[model samples]
Target: MQTIMYGIPNCDTIKKAKKWLDDNNIPFLFHDYRKDGLDSNLISQLYQTLSWDELLNKRSTSYRALTDQQKESLNEKSASLLFIEFPTLIKRPLVIHQGVAIIGFNQKNYQTFFAV
Candidate 1:
């Protein structure tokens, strides 16, 4: 299956996910949002597959740093804007495999999804 992993390079979860993929001999492309810049269309596509609440990294420092109004008023459009402006607000290691969008890393999930 064709796979693409998206995230900032320095994210620890991303590092672990990459290592796991490598160890499992999975050949996939890595898209560094920080370097490549996230397209609004791509963000919208992902949002369609996974809702804003699912894709957004609420636990991230970026999310935590948001104002009360921003947090309380977050909707699809606003959240999309935030993600575009600050890629870090999106969850790390968003893996798209065989047209499936998997947000965040979980060893068991990867094992089940990839059948590795």
Candidate 2:
């Protein structure tokens, strides 16, 4: 499978990751969730491979805005649905490299992931 990075287009981390991939001569497909839309299958796959704590972006404004009730009631299924409903709640630039789900970006992690 082709490497794909999923996130909002304007995200800084996404921008950095994109630039890093390009700089490294790594070819990848960028999927903008806000423009291209999100799907349950991807979310489900991520949920299965990783923990909810890894998948959810608790630091995002979208997640921070969640009501205490909503936050308290969140579970795997509910969090999955919430991520689908508001893709911003999901972590930035979820990089799918060689069919593996990577939740965030950093130079070291990218280097390790790609062995660059």
Candidate 3:
């Protein structure tokens, strides 16, 4: 299955995920969203598959720094805008394997998804 991994290069979770993929021999294209910049269409596509809540990293420093109004008034469009402006606000290591988008990293999930 073709896979693409999206995240900031310095993210610890992303590092772990990349290492796991490497160790398991899973080849994937790594997209550094912070450096590469997020495509609006791709963000829309991910939003369609995953909830705004899922895509939004509420635990992120960026998220925490948001005004209460910004956090409380979140909807798809607004959240997308926020994510486009702050890539770190989106979760790390969003993996798309064979067109299936998986958010976050977990060894067990990777094992099951890749069947490795």
Candidate 4:
């Protein structure tokens, strides 16, 4: 199975997800969005499966720091632009398998979805 995990290494959720995958002997690649740039196309694709509200991290300081105009006027295009500019603005540990884009990591969700 071709799986790609995207997140910052220091994130606890990412750490736990990585550990879970490791324990299950799941082979996957890690994509550090902070190091490697996030693709606009990938973000757009993710948007198709997950809404901007789901993919975008509204809780992060990066998102919170946005001006009122940016926050209020947020659309798919604007959200995608923010994600490309600040990967940290994305929710942690997005996992991709086949054409499936998994948003946030959850123990039950991971188990059911990834079968790990």
Residue 39, candidate 2: Cα error in Å is 2.5
User: TM-score, each model?
Assistant: 0.94, 0.92, 0.93, 0.88
Winner by lDDT between candidate 2 and candidate 1: 1
Q: Where is the poorest 10-residue window by lDDT in model 2?
A: 44-53
**Model 2 deviation from native, Cα RMSD in Å:** 1.3
Alpha-carbon shift of residue 97 in model 2 (angstroms): 0.8
Q: Give the residue spans of candidate 4 off by over 4 A.
A: none
Q: Write the per-residue lDDT of candidate 2 for residues 20-116, one digit (tens) a residue.
A: 9999999999988878877888777776667777888999999999999999999988898898898999888888888688777889989999999
Clashing pairs in 1: none
C-alpha local distance difference test of each model: 0.90, 0.87, 0.88, 0.85
Candidate 2 vs candidate 4: which has greater lDDT? 2
Decoy 4 TM-score against native? 0.88
Ranking by TM-score: 1, 3, 2, 4
lDDT score at residue 94, model 2, on the 0-100 scale: 89
User: What alpha-carbon RMSD in Å does predicted model 4 have with respect to the real structure?
Assistant: 1.6
Model 1 agreement with the true structure over 1-116: per-residue lDDT tens digits: 67999999999999999999999999999999978879789888787678988888989999999999999999999998999899999988899998888878899999998997
